[model samples]
Target: MESSSNFTPFLLFLSATLTVLSSVSANSEGDALYALKRSFSDPDNVLQSWDPTLVSPCTWFHVTCNQNNRVTRLDLGNSNLSGHLVPELEKLEHLQYLELYKNNIQGVIPPELGNLKNLVSLDLYNNNISGIIPPSLGNLKNLVFLRLNDNRLTGPIPKELVGPPNLKVVDVSNNDLCGTIPTTGPFEHIPLNNFENNPRLEGPELLGLVPYATNCS
Candidate 1:
């Protein structure tokens, strides 16, 4: 009888521990996003609703959450937001879509974005963003659509972003990207026109030839 009572206390403690851990995990993501909100210059007051004191970021504008209240999407496209992206965004572990297209947001792609293993679509096209595509983005095995077109980005396309298992669409066109195009994995199926307008970018690299390291810098 005493052992049974002890077991009940243990069970309660374990449950409480799990609950606290889950809450902390969810809050961590919220904190990361709030950091992003603080980094931007929101000309449209689009991010004014992002109050950190909220129980969760699910209540914020341009943010979406899963059934578990974990952040899953951020739809801030065309919001006229400027300023650089924060590396703190890497904390959004469950993020699937990051849509910041058509904004004036400028700066380099955060290599920490590779930490978002659950990402599906990444659309930052039509912005003034510059800097080389991070090789770390290759870690997003779940990535499907990657559109960074019409930017001021320079340097060779990182070969790391070529072979995501679910990739379907990639449009880096109209950028200042250099080096030979990757012709492996998902790259083999992307249409040539999608890569058009990059003056220095070369071939869907040939069969046996050693592809450019794309690290010309």
Candidate 2:
């Protein structure tokens, strides 16, 4: 009878251990989502519905998760969110789509965003962000679509972004940028509209014109 009593406590210990392990796994997912939530300062409470108490981000609005319960899509475009882009977003290892266009976010593009190796589409256009494009963004090897138009970003276009192998669409117009646009690879195929309004920018063909030739010289 005494031996049975000892075995009962052993079983209880095993059950408790399993429970703790399960809780840890659950909290880890919550922690990642929570970190992303905390990065943005939602002034109009657009993201107030993103509560940690929710069992999974999959059930949350505007957040799509894969079968494994990992967040893969974050589409919050035109949600009126106003804040700076946070480097903490790199924690979403499985994120594939991130859309936050038509907002008021303002700041330098965080180089750490390159850590999202699985990212395929990133759209942050029509914002107030101001900064030079980070060369580290060239590391998004899987990026297919990237848009950052109508912003306050300044400086020369990073040459590294000219011809990323997987890149198909890139828009960086209406910004305060300058320099001779690269004439190789993707740059050669992009239309004049893509680099318009940046008065200092000179394309290969444009450089031969009398007006452009004088400025470029």
Top-TM-score candidate index = 1
Candidate 1 lDDT, tens digit per residue, 1-217? 9999989999999999988877887789889999888889997799999988876889998899998788899999999899889899999999999999999888899999999999999999999989999989899999999999999988887888776989999999999888888888898899999989988887777774855845355
In order, the Cα lDDT scores of the candidates are: 0.89, 0.76
Could you tell me the lDDT of residue 76 within candidate 2?
A: 86
Clashes of 1: 0
Residue 79 in candidate 1, Cα distance off native in Å: 0.8
Measured against the true structure, the TM-scores of the candidates, in listed sequence, are 0.94, 0.77
Task: State residue 132's C-alpha deviation in candidate 2, in Å.
Answer: 1.2
**How does model 1 score by TM-score?**
0.94
| Shift of residue 191 alpha carbon in model 2, Å | 1.6
Question: What are the RMSDs of all candidates, in order?
Answer: 1.7, 6.3
